[model samples]
Target: MSESNSAGMFSGRKSEGLVLVVDDEPDVRKVVRMTLEKSGYTVLEAEDGEKAIAEMKKDENSLLLSLIITDIRMPNMNGIDVINYYRKEWPSVPLIVLTGFPDMDMATSMLQHGIADYLVKPVEAEKLRSSVSKTLEKREVHGF
Candidate 1:
């Protein structure tokens, strides 16, 4: 890991890029925030996809969203629709989808559509950080 990444992982939250955590479950949101914040990312919470969209829109500098971790199944809107809208509106925001489903075909389709990464439910802290860091690196390379 680079020095910056090491600092992010261990030195505790010096960096301040906003990360949106979208899940219907309160516990998931709480844990995700705790994990990412501990790793140096500022986290924002939204219960469902609709609220997530609203939060993104309410902020003027939506491009600063370092990452969006969204669950696939939600009440008002789903992850797929959220992905579609983000692609249309805020393409700069890197998305990491979380889902309970393990269908390879659906995962393949989501990958093709522009998600930075995907995670299965009950994400480990290391796995989540790894994906977040990987996506951030991709953003740096792609000129986000």
Candidate 2:
């Protein structure tokens, strides 16, 4: 695989820290990774929540992840589980949820669990960038 296609690896803007993106779809991961990388952030990707957790555990000893962006549904594990685990294990790391299914109940539940932001599927590049920037800035200001 080319350097760009490597999962759990980063290229460009090392100074910006790392963001973990968990999505079951490879296309979604590619688009999100490219968008963030262009905005001067390094990105790591996992195919599902289980792999995301594994990646987090592996990187915990090395990289200081700045954020997590995850899809709501996936095989093996889902975003809610990922969020819950992170909330307890890595409370300071911010999370953003992206879901094709925008249920009011689900959104409300995720918000109550401390998700930084939520975006529906087919997210525009600019909107994603804005959400990520705002979320990171909020965390910085709050001393997370």
RMSD of every candidate to native, in Å, equals: 6.0, 3.0
Using lDDT as the measure, the top candidate is 2
Candidate 1 global Cα RMSD: 6.0
Candidate 2 deviation (Cα RMSD): 3.0
Per-residue lDDT tens digits for candidate 1, residues 1-144, read 222212123344357567888888878888888887777777777887677778766644365577888887865555577688667766778888888877788788899888888788777999998899888888889887
Model 1 alpha-carbon drift over 4 Å, by segment:
1-13, 59-63, 76-79
TM-score of every candidate relative to the true structure: 0.81, 0.83
Q: Which candidate number maximizes TM-score?
A: 2
Off by over 4 Å in 2: 1-14, 59-63, 76-79
The residue pairs found clashing in candidate 1 are 13-40
lDDT score for residue 97 of model 2: 93
